[model samples]
Target: MYTIGQVAKFLGVSRDTLKFYEEKELVKPKQNIENGYRKYNRFDIYDITTVNFYREMDIEIKKIQELRKSKSIEGIKSLVDEKEQEVLKEIEYKKLILKKLQIVKEDCEKIKQFLGKYTVKEMKPLEIRGEIEHYTAYEEYETLKENTDSLKKAVTLTSLRRVIRFNDEGMLEDKFIIVRKVEDFEKDIEGEIVSHPKCMYTVIEDGRWSTGGKNTDHNVEASLRKAAIENGYKLLGLVYINLLLTTYEDGLERVFLEMYVPIK
Candidate 1:
């Protein structure tokens, strides 16, 4: 048996929350006869602990009360099964956010290279992009040339096509580009993974990763792998080099890629 204060101390919850829980009929504390104070027995402590754990797991208070009302193993199992997908999805989102943060930190380290002269600005909703399709890994270089040739022959893209940085949501499994047009969906796209530019990426400070394209002149994958290892995290997944900006230079079209890794 314990008093309200004692129970709160034992369970590491604020007395106010426990009182609120009682007021909500979530927990019914035993009554004290002499002064009509609240007394929490061992059952109350167990209930509070369970509630705290569920709350930490982001379970809704109303749902917890419903479970308490049903108080059946089958009902509890069914509720848990329904919640499993949501929990997993949230975890995946958190992992991607963390990875993005790490990538941003790395980019900030080499401020001049990544930012150039650009100042900070809020990102608006990404505009629609056009894309070419059916490019193979080996012919990725020639495919880019072909796409450029087509771009020249057709109406020049009035709106510059920029590759938008995308947070992985378990659907982006293939390496592809976001272009100004999608001419061939089945053949030209989803064929080339190595044709695009690659770079070595690493997190420097503030848990963000940035790719330095210095290794572009040499072995691309090896340099990127070295950078990943140097950053104190393993290469758990594929790195996405997003072509955020593009321009033509010296008979070569250069695209600035935002190198990214998904982390958990």
Candidate 2:
């Protein structure tokens, strides 16, 4: 027989942990009647070791208790199978997080390379769904919620500013929209899918979404008109501004937007 202190030191655990195991009735240590000291036998040590092994496998205390009383080999196998499935699910979730992290790193690089630069490039056609804005309709909100379940999926949704042209009044109007990228296999999408082709591309620093003064100073239609005349290219349809990155500078929020004005 050994003292609780001796067992704790040998097993590399705390005194409170041993006491907790005793309280859970996982181990019954002999108590000295005179000094009221807990005495642990070799059998108690073995039980502690077994309990520790189950815990390292992330088995809950209640489950460990049930396992201690479980005598059937099939019961033990079933528990191990359940734990294996849980670990597999956790691994897949971690993989999704890793992919999102890599995308964020690439976005940061884009900001460094393309901030405030103007050029014409071919924009990829996208099939997207979702609406995240203050005035989003109830139907759109329900559909967005029904489509995605994870934060990674929700944030991966492409954000855009739809600029409607008012050529008569020499003005431009814009609204922000957030939408999810619809995979090619998805056939149940309820609405029309929008697409963009060749565009006058540029990245600009601005405020969050389409608000604040940056949108006013960096006018989308006017900028595209100027760029078109300068490059001797004629502009076509409505403008699409895709949000790339958002960060803070000197206590003010800043957003990097990728503008796509289609050109003929």
Best by lDDT: 2
lDDT of 1 at 264: 26
Cα lDDT of model 1 by residue, 1-264, tens digit: 788888878778888999989987888998878998998878888888888887886778999988777758888777777788888877877785686568556644544354322122212222233343333344444544444423223422222332323222322344454333334333444332322222333322111122333334124444544555565444444554433444455545554444444332
Error of 1 at 7 (Å): 1.2
* lDDT by residue (tens digit), candidate 2, 106-220: 8788778777667777766454444444334444555555555455445233443444554535646545454545566777766457666677788877774445554464365
The 10-residue segment with the lowest total lDDT in model 2 = 152-161
Instruction: List clashing residue pairs in candidate 2.
Output: none
lDDT agreement of model 1 with the native: 0.52
Which regions of candidate 1 fall more than 4 Å away from where they truly are?
32-36, 109-264
Q: Best candidate per TM-score, number?
A: 2
